[model samples]
Target: MDVVKPKNQRSKRALEKRAPKLIENPKTAMFVRGGHISQIVTDVMTDLCKLKRPNAVLYRKKNATRPFEDPTTIEFFSQKSDASLFMYGSHNKKRPHNIVFGRMFDHHLLDMIELGVEQYKPMSSFTSIKSSVGIKPCLIFSGDSFETEPNYAKLKNLLIDFFHGSDVERVDLSSLETVITFTVSDGKIFMRVYHIALKKSGTRTPRVELEEMGPSLDLVLRRTHIASSELFKLATRRPKALKPKKEKNISKDPFGSKLARIHMTRQDMKQLKTRRVKGLKRKRDTAQEEGEGTESSPKRQN
Candidate 1:
């Protein structure tokens, strides 16, 4: 994409929004429906756009894109919109109800993983209660596959990046009204979203419960375009300014928890100064009279 010179302040602000950052902003996703999208896939995209709102852009018109065949098409869209993440939905005989989840780095495709939706339930299926738009979702991933299988692990990371929302210093419990759960089992991924219901429990903290809020999906793993380890490392590398500087006596373990070492010279117990107590002080000896008195000394009358 060519860098367009800004003609006005509005255009300059637009360019600044797309510029790189040390503390990157929340990832914005562009929702695109393919030429042959099904109603189920379209609804899924719509519900997802609702959740990603304010930061997301939904292209109402269907577009022609085969990411596996011509990746440049999606790459072009990504560049034009200045969005790093995207969801593309399409359907066909072979891969019915197909959806692609992808992310870009430096305006280039970093990763794209496709999943075929086997079963889907739209938001309309659920009741009236639903989460507000653009709330950061609490992501929960279950099953061992997400950790053991390479592809599943990558997909887990991609989903997290797409839905985690913007970063914040502290989150109010009341603001936590949405959850997205992903479970891996039997070579399939089950996805669910819930709205947290806070009811009075007769206590300071309210009782929390989950109400099924729609867009439930059962998906089967399909094609994937994952960047190599080196490329991925480069794309995910943190800015030097954001990284913690190595301190002289402090270090972090694999878990990122800090550990510190103290340096001190050896001490001589005898010479070391410590709190003094009368009990611990040495007693001084007084010299005795050279000769002992034979008789009791006469008491002087006062």
Candidate 2:
């Protein structure tokens, strides 16, 4: 005798079992290359740190090793509790300037959970992950267009502010193409812009790719990377409307003094007087009752 099975039930069971296995072993991982990639990752990681209730780790490799080789992995991992939005950064010497950004299918940090390691353990509760990845800092700029000298200078200043040091040696510009690349140290972070242009014809809005970079950074430079974003023209546009000045004769009454005055007319005063009279009458009645009770009470025996 043969047992009959429903096709959909079997499919669902198979998927449930296979999903975990796939997550346990991810097939495709992000890869970063070039000298500025490390800095890009650093900047991105810095921003990730700003998230609330976040678990982030940053680590550098002790010994240099080849890419995809054992003992050569440097990585950063970040996750929120019970969330399937884990962000990972992986790097190695073979890809010295190469960095990889990845997300767990479930974003639950199941790899650590499976290993029985608590999220961001052994470090301060506020500490990000301590990975073996080395640091490479670089300047990143985004704007509507870096084509003009002034615009380029503005972008340069923004980058200078972002990296903070003269260590930024390579500059990658993809603003015109709505893309940005920053390479510093041994890592790189790439950003793709998405939004309205700040300028009518020369500005752009930017969207920081949080998941694309492996880690979070303190400061990430996301300029208006569009060709015509309002912010792009903000540096050049005239104000459409000026704020009105306060009138010297106008009183600053938050409680609407005019309305209050209107409500405090003679009729209102009469009603208030009536309320006070009633309140006093009630008080007098209470006093008279207390006096009568005192008089009626028998004198205490000596």
Candidate 3:
């Protein structure tokens, strides 16, 4: 006997086999290279530290230009620190204050996202100004184009991962006060933060609204590498069964052997007419009657 599978099943199996596996324990490691250090890099590091990750190491390389020039250097530091996520920062004339966020699969660089800061502001520059800034409480993703856009989904997931940090918790949305919202339109990813707000009306429940917050970033994402989707599938794959399930004989009827057709033909003409009428009248009932071959005798003789 030959077994047949649908087109989708075959394609899914092929994809799963080629997928990259995600690291179980994602240890993040950062390397700050080159002479001039930007404040954005330090701010990002501070944010990472605030996340309180279990394992995160930061390395500084002084007076060197283009620290990320060699892939071997990255692999060297990755293996030495055993980190699955790496962040590289450098500054130069062409693109000042550049940061590269990348992930590793099997100790190899799998995907990278590079973002360059067009403007700069140091924390020391604002020290004299008597003003305080607070983190936002909400995020919203919008745009009519996102309904059919594919990259919209990818950017949404990335934003979630970026804001939630390494360790994510599945809890009440209200608990995650810091909200990150993405609005995609005209081939652009617009990220905005908000604070959840409520407005009161006459004898009615307060209308919920989102108030825009500050420190908004319009990041131009340059995808250096495509992230492996295989890691997630591999992590979720079920172990193969030790042995195939045993097939058991399923008796079609509970009583005994079915009566032969010849024996059924011996029924009275009136009963045959009744059965034929019954079969033609209700389609479902006829199918059940024919399938079971229920006894035609008015009274079953034990």
Top TM-score hit: 1
lDDT-better candidate, 1 vs 2: 1
lDDT of 3 by residue, 78-117 (tens): 7767665666776666766676766555566655666665
Q: Rate the local accuracy (lDDT) of all candidates.
A: 0.89, 0.32, 0.53
- Model 1 CA deviation exceeding 4 Å by range: 1-8, 251-260, 264-302
Instruction: Give the per-residue lDDT of model 2 (tens digit) for 260-301.
Output: 222343555434644445456777788998899999999999
Residue 87 local lDDT, model 3:
68
lDDT (10s digit) by residue, model 1, range 123-171:
8898948988778899999999999999999999999999878999999
Q: Sum up the clashes in candidate 1.
A: 0
Best by lDDT: 1
Q: In candidate 2, which residue ranges exceed 4 Å CA deviation?
A: 1-40, 47-80, 105-190, 194-302
Question: Could you arrange the candidates by TM-score from highest to lowest?
Answer: 1, 3, 2
Give the backbone clash total of model 2: 52
Estimated TM-score for each candidate: 0.83, 0.20, 0.49
